[model samples]
Target: MHELAIAQSIVALAEQQAQNRHAAAIEEVELEIGVLAGVDVKALDFAMKSSVKGTLMENARIVRHDIAGEGRCGDCANVFPVNRLFENCPACGSYAVNILKGKELRMKSIVMATIGLQP
Candidate 1:
């Protein structure tokens, strides 16, 4: 699954960040996942857990923020909630819709453990 690759990438990034800060370990990782991002959350979670083994983030807490999908009608300028891509506009029933949100898969923040610091 691509989730495994994604997880590995995330781990690498976290490790890089921790090393850059001279951290002893990673304490937490905050992620933002959008509904329309096409990533399976459960699978990604499992992949992340597996990927962190023996890594700096092995004991880190993983926090995920699920962002809801939203879109704006290109024809009528109406904003509405969307579940998937290429959705027809609810107000004008047009296929020309511009996505306003919910296409994100990014790391929002990371908490690292400094040397001799109790977290």
Candidate 2:
């Protein structure tokens, strides 16, 4: 599924970041997934396990943050939250609405283990 590809890409990016910082291992991965992104959180978690098998993030914990979709009405200029995808604005009941947020699939942050030994 598409989620698998996204998971693979996330793992690749995390590995690259870990290498750049000379990290020994990846501890956690924080992701911000928008409601309109159409990503299955459970599927992503499973995909991460398979994708990071040979990478530095093999044991990393995938942390997902779900963001609600938001849009601004072009007619009334009102901003409101949306749970489903559609063209109509909830505030003004206008079809001319612009999406302000959501529909985003991105890795927000990463918690990495130090390269050197720790007590």
Candidate 3:
């Protein structure tokens, strides 16, 4: 699954960061996912469990932050939710809308624990 490959990449990135900071293990990996990113959280979680088997992020928790889609109306200069993307603006019924948010997937933060450090 693509999630497996994605998770592997995430682990690799986190491990690299941990090593750079001299951390022992990854504590958490925070992600921001827009509604239009089409990422399956459950599948990603399952993939992460498998991908981190023996990596520095073996116990890292994946924290996903869901983002909503927004559309800006060209006619009315208003912004509103456009979950379906095909629907017109709820405020002004304008078909000439541009996406202001959504279709984004990014890693937000990586929390790591240093070797022999407690807290």
Which candidate comes out best when scored by TM-score? 1
lDDT string, candidate 3, 6-97, tens digits: 88888888899999999988999998888766777789888889899999888888899888898889999888886856669788787999
For model 3, state the Cα shift of residue 60 in Å: 1.1
Worst 10 residues of 3 by lDDT: 81-90
lDDT of 2 by residue, 8-83 (tens): 8998899999999999999999999998888988898888889989889988888889988998888999888877
Better candidate by TM-score, 1 or 2: 1
**Residue range 1-119, candidate 1, lDDT tens digits:** 98899999999999999999999999999999999999999999999989999999999999999999999998999999999999999878999999989999999999998997656
Q: Rank the candidates by lDDT, best first.
A: 1, 2, 3
TM-score of each: 0.95, 0.90, 0.83
Local distance difference test, candidate 2: 0.88
Off by over 4 Å in 3: 116-119
Whole-structure CA lDDT of model 1: 0.95
Total clashing pairs in model 1:
0
The 10 consecutive residues of candidate 1 with the worst lDDT sum are 110-119
